[model samples]
Each structure stands twice: as structure tokens, then as C-alpha cells.
Target chain A: MTRILADRAARLLDFLWSGWAGLAALALLFACWQAGHETWGDFILPDPLATLGATWSLAISSESRGLLLLTAQRALAGFTLAAFSGAVIGIIAGYAPAVMRLARPLLTVVLGVPPIAWIVLTMMWFGTSGATVAATILISATPVVFVAAAEGIASRDRGLGTMAEVFRYGALGRFWFIDLRQAAAPLFPALALALGTSFKVAVMAEMLANAGGVGGALARARAMLDVPQALAWVVLAVIALVVVEYGLIRPMQAEIEGWRRAAQPWGVKK
Target chain B: MSAALELHRIGHAYFGQSVLNSIDLQIAPGEVVALVGPSGSGKSTLAHIAAGLVEPREGRVTPGYARHAMIFQEPRLLPWATAAQNIGFALRRAKLPRRLRPARVAEAARLAELEPQDLAKYPVELSGGMRQRVAIARALAVRPDFIFFDEPFTALDVALKRRMQDLVIAAAEEAQFAALFITHDLVEALRIAHRIAVLDLRGRGIAGLRILPGDPGARDEATTFALRQRFLTEDPLFRHIHDVDERRRP
Candidate 1:
């Protein structure tokens, strides 16, 4: 039908339009790379197209796919665990100011310690295993989610609680439906940030600890002084980050916040 | 039948300053009593006391009947809930069977003049009038024996206010629900209330009560306007109210 075709066209337009800003940023990065390429002459930085071709080949290869998968799996596992624990503790802390005050110092200390330091400590304990990579990511990302969820819970609309009470909605019903709905808004942006952190920490841990992932592959490329290949692995990791964030997280945000679409200027009522 | 609600010698104070002093009022079954007062006359505090929202320091409320509800000045709808879901929330509290909730919500929505398409929209998606209608629908969904109207239509425009008042009057008649309507608008009080109970601004308790003559919710705009003019001339509170209005009307 013409309607179906029109809908598909509109969706395609939306998809392309959403990527325009990212494309512009990538163009800027490429320009910087071109300047360096012109200066170093294919030894230090290499041509952007050479790195793009290397990334394309890496994308096609089974070994590189496995390395990408390993890194993704570790990052996601750590993020899931952190999200669960952080939301629980953060919600409790939000309701109890004493708990938040007590935890503030500890949270600052944990967040201030760099991911590299956590990687070193985790490596000493887990010794170049996937566990070290997961541990490092959990440490680096959990605090961001916790702080966001806590702040969200603390600042939720107070009228909703009273409204729920007037309706005589049970305690559990009020908490799960009303309280959680308000908290989820801010928590989601923090979650996106944490997911990015998880990826960064995972790759860093893999390279430093010799864990088998994209970071390990990047280490191999670095030792061989294959500039394009090294850039190719970096590009592949970034591609993974962009794909997960845009593909998974963005759609969920759109669905939950769909009510805002109605707030847009309608111009004329239907 | 027993009285629907009774407030016996209710007295309250915030930080030792008396807001309500030995306030007493009663609502018979199916009666609509409007509580009228100027700002800071403890009209809201008395309404809250009657609804058991805030406990009266000196007396008590006897909510004799089951399934009472309140419609506040603000819509106070849960933003996350769709219109139908918000109505369904009230049905749940009314203890309708889970399977029957959707039907009852739809029926209440019909009574409140909410369209079916609006049922799926969240509070943020609804207009100011539509959101108030949703709140009205939620209050009426339970088919309650009593409802407290705490100046619920103040935010609405004149047309919307009339519409909402009509809905409340219709619901009150059809369900025979007792209501304690609170407002500063004398015309609105006259429109929806069977009798007006005026709260004294210079003091803490009710000053007078006036009963109106007519079938409630009947579209007698001329009759209501006549009664409103009489109130402006005769009622002390309304005369005081008119003096303020007289100064402002240029």
C-alpha cells in the first residue's frame, strides 16, 4: 500500500537525520587524522581511508568478530550487575538521608580512583582473566548509576505520593508504579553513561591484563606498529558502543518518554 | 438512612495558631453541601479534616458510609498513568474485580465526557480541561457514597467550570452521593450545592447556612443567576465578597 511505503520512507528519513550530528563529528575527527597523515606520511597516523579499509576487513574476519563479541559480553554483564545493585541501593539511600550522608565519602573515594588503578588491583586478584575485566568495569561504572538513581528518587514529584494515598493505592503499588516511574527518568541517562563507562573500562582492563578481547587485539596491533590496524580496532570498539547505545537504549528512552511528543506544538488540533 | 458524614466539634491549629475552632458540620445521605469561604478561612483545612487527610486536634470525623472519594482543586493525576489507567486505579481501590475494572473505567469515562481515544494518553498528553475530567472520572468511577470537592474547578475556564459542575451535579444526583464542596466562588457554590455553608473569614467556624430551591443539576441558568444576585445583596460573606469585586470591576 502507499501508506506502508510512506511510513517506511518517513522512518528511513528519521534514521538518517538522527545520525547527521554524529557524522559531522566523525568528519571533524577525520580531518584531524588527515592533517596528521599529511605530516607523518602513512607511518605514525596513516590515511583515514587505509584505516577505514582495515576496519572493514576486521569487521569481516571471524577472529576479530570473536574478539568484539568477547568484549561486548564482558561489558554488558558488568553493566547489568551494576545497574541492578546500584538501583536497589540508590533507591534505599534516596529515601534515607542518613544513608546517603554516610555513603557520600565512600562513593567519592570509589569514583575518584581511576579505572586503570582498579584494573591493576583486579589483575592482581583475578590475574589476566575475564573476571579482572568485569571487576574493573563494575567498579568504574556502578557509582555513576547509583548517584543518578539516588538524585532522581530524591527529586521526584511529591504530589504523586499524596495522590496515590488519596486513591488508597497499597504501599507496594505506590512504590513500584509511582515512585519507580519518576526515578526511571533520570536513572536512564545515567545508565547510558554507565554503559559507555563499562565499555571503556572493559577494553582498558583487557589490554592491561592481557584478557582476550578487542583490547587484546588492539595490543597486538600496537606491538607490530600497524597504525591502520590499531586505529581499525579502536574504530571497531567505537562502532560497538554506537550500535548498542543507539539501537537498544535510544528506542527504550523514546518509548518511556513518548508522552513528551504530545507536548510539541501541534499548530492545529485534529 | 444514617448521615453520610459528620464532623463533630472539629478544631485544628498549625503551630498553636488556631485555624479551625470547634467547627461542626454534617452531610445527610445524597446531600450536596458547599463550604464557602475567602482565602485563609480554614475552608481547605476543614475539608481536609472532613476527608480525614489531616486529623483534627480537638474532634473527629465519622465517615459512616463506605467508598468515599475526593476531587481536589488540582487534577492530581498520576502523570505516568493513562486516562483509563488512572480511572482504573480508583476502581481498584473500590475493590471491583480485576476483570471488571476496564468496563467500569470506560463507563466512568463516558459519564465524565472523556473520549475513548484519550484513554490511552498520559497526563502530560491531556489538556488542562481533559486532565480535570480524568480526575473527575477517577473520583466517580467507584460509584461512591460520598465525595469531597475541594474547589476542584478553580483552574478551569468558565465554560469548562460549567461542564465540570454539570458532571459533578449529574453524578451526585444519579449516585445519591453526599458531597462537601469547597470554593470561594459564590456562583459555583450556588450552581452545584443543594445548600451553602459559609465559613467566616473574621473567625474560625461556619457563620451561616442557606438552602436553595430546585432540582439539583437542572439547567436553570436564569434561576441560579437570580439566586446569585440575592446572595450578593443579602449574605454577609457574599456582600464582603462583592465589595472586593466592586473595587476590582472597572
Candidate 2:
């Protein structure tokens, strides 16, 4: 038990140390943003500091904070729906080739249709509500997770399956312990991609449907030509994405992928 | 006396191509029987059939043992799990109480000669030999009366292979488990198996069986080498053991 705790503590420290690289990358991005602001002046692109000030003011106000919460809820709800259903269907399709064959064309059709079209359609179907935003996000994100999970299951090592069979693992037991565990390698990356898509589509649907969220706030800023406010809302949306990805997705990924880290020898760990 | 495992007219085919046909074999309790064959002789297929990993196209597998485990050609350890966890994986199937598992896992690890610190490491973090040790530990953890080894040490270097064979000999002797050890190497078969069964080139049947002079693990290296040389050079049953017919491999 002490060894496990110590290992977790070491991993936590390693995670914190890795944040320096992330900060360095963020600084580089900010430098490029500053360059663009200087090139275009205040009319086209606002300076990063001004945008930060606007973001801080917006974040401090109760009204804008509520809007942010609404958007986060919509994104999370839609993401949950997509993750669950897509993973189930994908896993089923993965095990059954006929179902996979059927799902392929359907996935192609769903992916081929643009997210803007879905947003427009969902707006008509669900009106200017959270449902519209959520439906749009689901339509846009489900296929990514579906494809990922399906491929993950399809490519699993059959040797492991045989090994499980030798141990007398039943169908459900093998699926739970071996197949699903193997599928997680590809599934996690797909989930991360799907999550990003969810948030993006959520905000886009909200803007188009006039739902009261950060996207609606951005639309208002656009109407008034408040570039700094618009940039602030964009920044807020990005911060929310980073928070969800790093806060939820990355920690879970780290826990599952520790073996991958162990594969790397000492003095070469990143 | 009842045999530990009995294969009566066991036959199997893949995609209508018969790979194993009308093979009959039996292992007494606490005996290590080595099954040696050419590359395409369906040795692994027969082992898989005996272990119940594959359904035979015909015939029955009557397993008289309480439980059985297998160690495959590759380590086949779950890469995501620690070495200890890999051993515990089999223990989970054994249905031992959850709290008692750690001790069982540690005991099996010790039997496999793995270091205490190595238990926490993943398969990829360990050396190739260590990875195979984890596989052996996994098989041993189940505490079965019967075990199947499908060329478990075929991938190891010469020295490592000998060590693993010795480990298996020690494990089987200590546990008194009946084993069907499949190998292409005659020396390996001689060193580890009490009796050697030569499989036919076309999987027609068990070609022949030879009982070695002394018990397994008691035979010296010089005797094993001499027996191996005699089998390869003089024994007609082993004439096709070293042959590689890729076209006929199932």
C-alpha cells in the first residue's frame, strides 16, 4: 500500500513538472498572438492584455459566469451521451463484422454532413434551447468516438483472448477484463478528440440558435463590434476546453497509460 | 489409475483443412510429457485443442485434472498490468478470496525466480527473459494440476531458454502438475520431460513415444545432450522434427 501511494505521488510530481513545457508552449502562442495584434492594430485583433482584462471582467460578473456554466453543462451532457452510446454501438460493431459493415456507411454519411447543417437542423427541431446545442454536439462528436472504439476492438490481440479462454473467462468476463482494457488504448484518444468537437459544436449551436451561453454572448459582441469582448469569450471557451481536457481526460489517461510510461527507460522520460 | 489429461481421437481442422487428425495422448499425474514436431505438424494446434482453447472438429477432450493453465509461445502477459497483476489475473479466475491474492501472487513470483521489486514493473519495462518469467508465474499462480506449455521458451536465447526449462522443471516437480510441453528442440524436451512424444509431419497421429532413462530434473546436461543427439541422428520418428514446411503450416 505504501508502494502504491509512493508511486502515485511520484506520478503526480512528474505531471506537475511536465506543466513547465506546457507553459513554455503557451508563451510561444502568446508571442505569436502579440505579433498578430501589432501587425493588424486594435481594429482587427485586440492585444492579449486587453483581451485578458475583458475576460477577467466577464468572468467576475454573475451573468457571464452563468452563461459559461450553461455552456459547460450543454457540452458535458452532449459529451456524456456521445461517449456512452458511441462506445456501446462501436463495441458491438467491433465484435460483429456485419454490424460494422452496416455502421460504416452510416458513419460516412453522418461525418460527411457538416456540423453547421446539423446545427441548423437541430435549431429547427429543438428551437433555441439547450437541446439544440446538445443535439448538435452529439451529432458532430459521436462518429469520432464510434470509429475509434470500433477500430480499437477490431485490432485487439487475439492471443490475449485465447489466454483468457484458457483461464476459463466467460464471454462477459473476457469483455470486461481483456477486450475492454485493450480497446481503451485507442478509445481514449478518440474520446479526447470527441470532447474538443463537443465543446466547439456546443458553442456553435448556441450562437446559431441564440441560446443564452458564451456563444450567445459572443454573437452580441459581434453585433456591437466589441472585438475585445468577442476575443475574451473565445479565450474563455478555450480555457474551458483546456480545463475539461486536462482536468478530466488527461488524469484518467495517465492512470490507464502508466505502463506505457514504464516502457521508457530512465533518464529519457518526458 | 486415471490419467491427468486424456485426448481420445482428438482432431481439428481450420477452414475445412484438417490440421490435426485422430490424435490420442494421455498424461499421468505429475508427469511432464514433451510433444515435439516439425513447424507445420500442428503441434500448437493440438496443444490448444488439449487445453480447450480450440474446439476440435471431431472427438472429445476429457480433462481429468481439477484445473489447467497454459503458457504460450510469446509471454502473452497483459502489457498494461504489472507483473504481480498479471499473476493475480489468473488467480482471479481461481476464485480465491480477494484479500488472500497478494500472498498467492508473491508466492508464485518467488517460484518463478522474479525479484520482489520486479513485481511492480510492467511487461515492457522488464527484460524479455523477465517477461517470460512473469508468464510462467502467471501459469503457476493458478495452482492447477495440469499445465500446457506451447513452446514457452522458443523466443529466448540459449541460456535463458535453459533457465526457463529448469524453472518449469522445478515448478512442475514442486507443484506435481502434469504438463504437455511442446517444443521443437530435442534437448529441451529431454531436459524437462519424463517422456517424449513425437508428432507426425501431417498430424496424422502421435508418431511415437519414448520414455527417458531417469526422472526429469535429475538428468544431467551430458545425458540430455547424448539423448538429444541419439534421437535426432538415429530415431526415425524424429526425422521430420526439424523440417520446416511453411506451405503446410496452419
Candidate 3:
């Protein structure tokens, strides 16, 4: 139909606008990099061509691929543990005021401590393994999720809750229909932040622990004074972070938020 | 059958200040009763108590039927739920199987005159009138034996209000369920109520009760208007209350 064609056309226009904007931004970035490279010469700054060559070389190597996969595995494991435990503890704390009160001081203490402060203790406990690295990541991200979930539950509309009670919707039905739906919007942003924090903290923990992963490769490259290779690994890590964020976390968020999208703008038309 | 609802000297207070005192009322099955009073006169409080949302501190409220539902002053639809989903919430606890819920929801939506496209929309997406209709649909979906309306059409425009009033009358006629409708609008109260109960703000018991004589279906506008004037002036209590409300109006 004509309406469908118009909708498709509008979508295509939005896509083109996004693509052009990104291209313009990238061009500006490349110009800055080229100018910096020229001023500093080869030792302090590598040319774009040289950086790309180094990145390609690293990408094709079997050892680099294994290191990348290992780093990804550690991030996934730590993020999974944090998300599962955080959601369970958060829901319980949200619903029960007594439990929330009991846990408040402890949660504050845990959230305030720097990641470095816990790194030595984690290393002492787990002895320079992936487990220690993962523990540090989990400890760093769980509080964010807890706060969001708790606030969401606290502010639910009491009138709707009363309606639910009048309908004789038992505990489970009440939770699913009223409580969970109210909590989900706040929970998504917290989950996204936790996911991003997992990847960043995992890399930092791996580097500090001197574990066998991309961090170890970076450490070795630094020691050998292979600055270009070290920078290449950093670039690889950034790319991995972007990929994981967009590919994994974003899709999950979209799936969870589909209902919200369908709700759309209700009032006056713009 | 006994009266659909009975209130035995019901009284309520907040912070030692009495809102309702020694109230006694009874509504028969398939009857519509309108409770009209000034602001802060405890009309809404009585409705809430009758619907079992709030319990009175003193005396008993006995409903002849077990099932009851309410429509508040505001629509009070859940922001997160679609029109269909919100209506379905009222039937969520029903004894019907899962597959029958959609049909029941559809039936209520139809009764409320909700359009197909609007059914998939959220409360925020609808206009004030549309949202009010959804709220009405939700209450009807429960198939309650008793219904309470607390100024349910206050936010609507004149045409929409008339449409909603007709819908309420139509529903009551079809279902034969008892209703306690609270409103400050005399015209609205007269149009729908089988009997009108005027509350004395200074005292607790009903000041007066007027039983309307002709069938709503057969009555014309002039007859209804004349009846409204007769109730306002011929009844001594109504005359005093109307003068006081007019004096108090800013």
C-alpha cells in the first residue's frame, strides 16, 4: 500500500541521516589523528596507515584471536553472575522493607570501596586466577542494579495495586502484572550499565592480576617496548567493547522494551 | 432477595475528625441510587466503604452480593497496560479458562464503544474521554453484582458526558445490577438514578429520598426537568441545602 511505501521511505531517510553524520564525525577524527602524527613523528605517534596495518596483523594471528576470546569469556561469566544475583537480591530487598533496612549499610559499604582496594584481597583469596578477576567485576556492578530495582518498586501506583487486590489476583499474578511491569523500566538502564562495567572491569582486573588473556599480551608488548602493538591491543579491546555492547546488551534491551515502544506517543500529535 | 447492599449506622473518621457519622442506607437489587452532597460531605468516603476498599471504623456494611467494582473520580488506568490488557486485568481472577479472557475483554470493550485501533493503545495515548471509557470497560469486565461510581464522568466534555451517562444507564438496564453513583451534578443524578438520596453535611442520616416515577425509557426531557425542579424546591431539606451551596459558591 502507499502508506507502507511512505513508512519505508521515512525509515530509509533516517538511516541515511545517521550514516552521513557518522561519516562526517569520522573524517574529523582522522584529520586530527593525521595532524598529531605529523607533529610527533613515528616514535610518539603512529600514522593511520601504520595503525591499521598493525591492527590487521594482530587480527589474523591465532594467538591474538585466542586472547580476545578468553577476555570475552571472562567478561561474559562475570556479567552473568552479577545480573542473576543482583536481580534476585534487588527484588527481595525491594519487596521487603525489613530486609532492605538490614542490607542498606552493608550495600553502601560495598559500593563505596574502590575496585583497587578489593583487588589485593581478591588476589589473596583466589590467587591470581580468572575467578579473582571475575569476583572483582561482580562486586563493582551489582549495587547499581539494586538501587534501580528498589526505587522502581517503591514508587509503584498504589491505586492500581488496590485494583489488583480487588480483582482477587493472588500473589504471583499481582507480582507479574503490577510489580514486575513497574520495575522493568528502571531495571533496564541498570542492567545496561552493569554489562558495560563488566567488560571494562574485567580487562582492568585481568591486567592487574597478570592473567593469561589480552591483558597479558598488552603487558608483554609494553615490556618489549612494542608501543604500536600495545596500542593495537587497546584498539582491539575498544572494538570488542563496542561489539559486545551493541550485539549483546542492546538487542536484549530492545527485546525487553518492545512493549514500551508499542505504547508510543499518546497525547497531542507533534 | 434482600437489598443489594445495607449500611448499618456506618461511621468513619480521620485524625479524630468525623467525615461520615451514623450513616444508614440500603440499595435494592437492579436499582440505581445517587448520593448527592456538597464538597467534604463524605459522599466518596461512603462509596469507598460500600465497595469494601476502605473499612469504616464503626458499624457494619453488608452487601447482599459478594462481587463489587468501582470507578474513581479519575480514570486510574494503569499507564503500562494497553486498553485490552487493562480491561483484562479485571477478569484476571475470574474462574474462566485462559482462552476465554480475550473474548470477555472484547465484549467489555464493545460495551464501552472502544474502537479496534484504540484497544491496542496505552492510557497515555488516549484522550481523557477514551481513558474514562477504558476505565468503565475495566469495571464492567469483572461482571460485578454491585458497582460504585465516584464522579466517573467529571473530566468529560458535555457530549462525551451525555454519551457516558447513557452508557451507564444502558449497562444497568441490561445487567440489572445495583449501583451507588455519587455526583454533584443534579442533572446527571436525575437522568440515571432510580432514587436520589440527598446527604445532610451537618447530620449523618439521609436528609430525604426521592423516588422517580416514570420509566427512564419513556420519559421526555421536559418531564425530567420538571421533576428535578420539584425535588429541589418542594422538599424543604433540598431547598435549604441548595441555598447553602449557592451561597458558598465563589
Largest DockQ belongs to which candidate?
Answer: 2
Model 3 chain B: weakest 10-residue lDDT segment is: B241-250
- Candidate 2 per-residue C-alpha lDDT over B1-250 given as tens digits, one digit per residue, 9 for 90 to 100: 8999999998888898888889999899998999998887899989988988788988889998999999999989898898899999998879899999999999999999999989987887789999999999999898989999999998999999989988998998899999999998888999999999998888998999999999888999889889888988998888878886777565
The Cα RMSD of model 2 versus the native structure comes to: 1.7
Question: Please, what are the lDDT tens digits per residue for candidate 1 over residues B1-250?
Answer: 7788988888888888787887778888889999887766778888888877788899889998787788888998877567888888777666679988888989889889899988987787788999999998998898888888888999889998988888888877777888999998988988898888887664356778888897667739899989988888765656654233223322
What candidate 1 gets wrong by more than 4 Å, as runs, is A1-40, A104-106, A124-127, A266-270, B15-18, B55-58, B97-99, B200-203, B218-226, B229-233, B236-250
Query: How many steric overlaps are in each model, in order?
Result: 0, 0, 1
Give residue B190's lDDT in candidate 2 (0 to 100).
94
Which regions of candidate 3 are displaced past 4 Å?
A1-35, A38-62, A92-109, A262-270, B15-17, B199-208, B215-220, B233-250
Q: Lowest-scoring 10 consecutive residues by lDDT in candidate 1 chain A?
A: A261-270
lDDT of 2 by residue, A1-270 (tens): 896798789988988998999999989998999999999999899999999999999989999989998999999999999999899999999999999999999999999999999999998999899999989888889998998899989999989988988888998888998999889999999999989998899888888899979889989999999999999999999899889999999889988877788677562132
Better candidate number, 1 or 2, judged by lDDT? 2
Clashing pairs in 3: A266-B125
Model 1, residue pairs in steric clash: none
Angstrom error of the Cα, residue A138, model 1: value is 2.7
- For all the candidates, what are their Cα RMSDs to the real structure? 4.6, 1.7, 4.6
